[model samples]
Target: MAGPEVTVVIPTVGRPSLAAALAAIGPGPEVIVVDDRRDARTPLPVPDGVRVLATGGRGPAAARNAGWRAATTPWVVFLDDDVVPAPGWAGALARDLGGLPGHVAGSQGRIRVPLPPGRPPTDEERNTAGLATARWATADMAYRRRALEAVGGFDERFPRAYREDSDLALRVRRAGFTLVRGERVTVHPVRDDGFWASLRRQRGNADDALMRRLHGPGWRAASGAPPGRLSRHVLTTLCGLFAAALTAMGAHRRRAGRAAARIAGLAWLALTAEFAWARIAPGPRTPGEILRMAVTSVLIPPAACAYRLGAEVALRTGGAR
Candidate 1:
């Protein structure tokens, strides 16, 4: 089958990788590139015949919505600018949707993350590579246009790309459509954005909390995500706080405060050490990498706890309809 049934929608910030991404895709279906860069600083040069739309600094969820709505094809295929499609990807995508039942809403492409050679990957690299096993990641995914409209597109309230795709998947499933794994393959190359990327990624903690609010506690299992260690992060942060408070009390008191402080101090040390080593072991162990891991590990638990707490209060109070 030709690729006419599908229109490729790429929502991108001004990454140089977009050119290579377009190059790997065979010329058959129409491609719509959504420029998510709000500023005019870096303009994406569009290929001939490809349509370009600007979301004016709105995040990816809105950009994707714009792309698919503009498409007239029966199937709307989404690709991230950073991914490279395998040869014959167009046909593979067509085949993936060729025989699906009417109740099937979408097909997710298989993602391959290539790892660095020689030394083990750093914590950040390993995290990026985990996308290979991630479900409904939308690095490459296709949806029947009808099913997409049925759900009112993605929730713009997501405000970021992190859990937005998963939220859409869950809604599709709840609406009686099943999502299947497709045969199409795309390679998601690991990003090397220096030391601070992982720390910055902690912002997703608020998104995670929003997901729980929208989809309920079962959202992770329903969407095929791991249950995660939010509980453990909370425990770690609480232990550290208790240890700090006990240390202050121990200075003023003698017997009970000292024993309790010792216990809390040991617990905090053990948790923090475990967290640090989990990061340090898989690392490249460069001076910069080591320093980054130590700082982020200390910061991540508290940050996760804070963001989640903030999200809970904000969502419950109802910012907008």
Candidate 2:
């Protein structure tokens, strides 16, 4: 049987990075860009010969589904607007797809984040490119159109950027198909943002909770996600604080008060050290970056836990799919 024709689908928030992505594709492959932004805000001009579809501000998951549905080809490669394919990417993809077994439903490419020399990755850079190994982002992945149809495309319940790709990949795997890693590579350019800006952008925790509800408590770690050390840190910090407060109120009971205060102080220091070292030891940073890390470190634990808890609760309560 002949291999199916490939169509490239990109979902963009109208970032300037789209131009780089467009320039990377080979000639004659049908490329569709789903514009998720409500207004024309991207500074990059649309390349000629590429089709642009407006999604009326729907999220990436929805935009991806729409884009795939509009594609006439048998295979669709989902590329993020922020990603640029490497040289010969299309040929590599075509060759890979042609040799795929019947049970293989999708393929994911390697994503390399181009960071400045001598600079450690910022939290934002790490988050944007998903520095963790073992899981593939939709930015450089391709899916079989038939498989997508069978699984009903991406789960729209994943409102934010996180977990949606994993969720889809999980479902696809469960349907008795293999998702292979391909030789096709893409460069995910690191975006420049302040420490606080990156922290504020983590609205995906809610979607993560939803994923847990849909999959299970083991979903995070099972899906190649890092351990929820942040959750543990937050819990420990809260316990320490409570112990200290109780001890302060019971100053008349000197023995217990002293013990409680000691425990609380120890816990607080431990959490602080862990947070600071994680950011600092990765690489050399400017004084400003170090200060930002120190300040943001205190806030990340609670913020992350809260988002995870909220997401799990909402999913259990049937708030989102």
Candidate 3:
């Protein structure tokens, strides 16, 4: 069979990085850019050959779908606005897909965050580039047009920017199509700078719960990957809180108040040490960044867990509205 025509679909929210993304693509490929914002505030001038679509404030999933639907190509490659493909990325993608079997539905590429030395990633940066491993990132993922159509494209229920790619990938896999990782690479530059802004973005935890409700409890370890040390931190915090409360109550009953206090104190120290170490070892930092890390580290676990739990409950109960 002849190689499929490739249509590169990029969903953008008017980020300046879109230009870099466009410049990275080599010639001889159809390009589609979906502007999700839809605002009449003057669209950026795309390169002469690229087709642009405006979705008028719909989410990325919708933008992607629009781009794909508009594509005449048999294969649709999705790239995020912030991603810049490396040299030969398009050629590598063509070669990779050409080599895949008929059952292969999609391909993922490696994503790297080109961070400067001596600075730990900000919370927002971590959120954006944390998935740098060789896997599925919307920034560098491509899908067979037929396969995407078979799975009904991306689910619009994933309102905000999270887990929509995984949802689609899981669906494609369940439909008896294989999603293989490709040799092509892209750089996901970390653009978010504010600390608290990143924390507020944890609203995606609600979407995680939605994914779990749709896919089941195993979705966390399966689609979303493991919860990591954040789970452990939550447990430690609860244990310490329980011990402290018990110790205060036991003072009237002459229970082992001293032992309980010591345990609680040890737990607090352990938590702080874990937080400091997680932040410090990445690289050298000024006292301000270190201090910010320390504060955010202590707050991140509980905030994340709370969001996750709430999202899970809401999604399971169908109360996301």
Candidate 4:
């Protein structure tokens, strides 16, 4: 079949890599680049023949909605600006979509994350590598336009790109369309991030809570997601807080309270140390890496718990469900 049956939609935030991504796509499909950059001061520039749409700084879900909504193709393929399509990926994608069955609503392209050379991958690298096994991420995914429309496209409630794709995939599946993996490959290089990057990522715990509220508690099992460590986090955080309270109460010379506080404090320290060591063992073991892992591990459980609690309140009170 002559190509162009699939329209490529890329939602970008003015990343410099966008040009390379477009270049690697190699001329076969109608390409639309949706600029989601909130900075209205400067516009994203694109090459000739590639259409550009501005979403006025909305998140990617909105940018993607605009992209696909403007497209007039049977299949709308989404690619992240940070990824580069492998050689001949366009031809492979054309075939990937064209060969799909009626019941197949979306096809995910295979993703390869190149790790840093000469060291066991740090926790960040390991996390980035998990994208390869992700069931459905839009780094390179093509969906039947009709299926997208039927599910009302990506949910804008998920402001961050973290869970938005998974939310859409879940809804698409619930609408009775199965998603399949495709042969097309894309390279999603791990970008450098701040020391607190992983720590800040705990904000996604709230997204997980929203997912549970919208899809029910069984959503994880239904979606094939592994059981997470939320329960352990909750226990760790509570133990830490309890230990602190007991220590404070015993400050006034109460012997019994002091003994209890000592026991609880030891338990908290043991859990924190064990969590930190697990992250440290697989790391590069540099001083900075060790410090980051130890500090973040101590902080993550409480932060995650707090986010989950906040999400429960927000979702239950009609916030972002």
Error of 1 at 30 (Å): 0.8
Better model by lDDT: candidate 1 vs candidate 3? 1
- List the pairs of residues colliding in candidate 3: 38-56
lDDT of each: 0.86, 0.78, 0.78, 0.88
lDDT of 3 by residue, 1-321 (tens): 235689999988898889999999887679999988858479676899888888888899899999999988878999998889999887887877886788998988888888756666654556565778624668788898999999889988887768898888888989999888887788887675665664576677767778877787787655646464556756766756666787767752555766666777688768767866666556356676667777776676667778888776766677543
Candidate 2 Cα RMSD (Å)? 3.0
Candidate 1 residue-wise lDDT at 288: 77
lDDT string for model 2 (258-280, tens) is: 77777777787787777777777
| Candidate 3 displacement at residue 49 in angstroms | 3.3
- Superior by lDDT: candidate 1 or candidate 4: 4
Please provide, for model 4 over 1-321, each residue's C-alpha lDDT reduced to its tens digit, 9 standing for 90 to 100.
Answer: 354388999999998999889999987899999988877568667888999988877888999999999999999999999999999998899888876788999999999999999998888888888888887898999999999999999988777877889889999999999999989999999875879888889898988998887888898877666678889888889888988897676652677777777777788888889889988998899999999998899999999999899889988788553
User: How much is 183 displaced in model 2, in angstroms?
Assistant: 1.0
Q: Lowest lDDT 10-mer window, candidate 3?
A: 221-230
Judged by whole-model lDDT over C-alpha atoms, candidate 4 comes out at: 0.88
Model 1 residue 234 CA deviation in Å? 1.4
Which of the numbered candidates is closest to the native, going by highest lDDT? Answer: 4
lDDT of 4 at 2: 55
> What tens digits encode model 1's per-residue C-alpha lDDT throughout 1-321?
653388899999889999989988887788999998879567687778889999987899999999999999998988999999999887888788887888988999999999988988988889888889898998998998999999998888888879999999988988999999998999999988877787788778898888888888888888888766678789998988887887765642767777777777788778878888888987888887888888888888888889889888898898534
The true-versus-predicted C-alpha distance at residue 251 of model 2, in Å, is 6.6
Evaluated with TM-score, which candidate comes out highest? Answer: 4
Tell me the spans in candidate 2 whose CA falls farther than 4 Å from its real position. Answer: 1-3, 40-44, 126-134, 240-262, 319-321
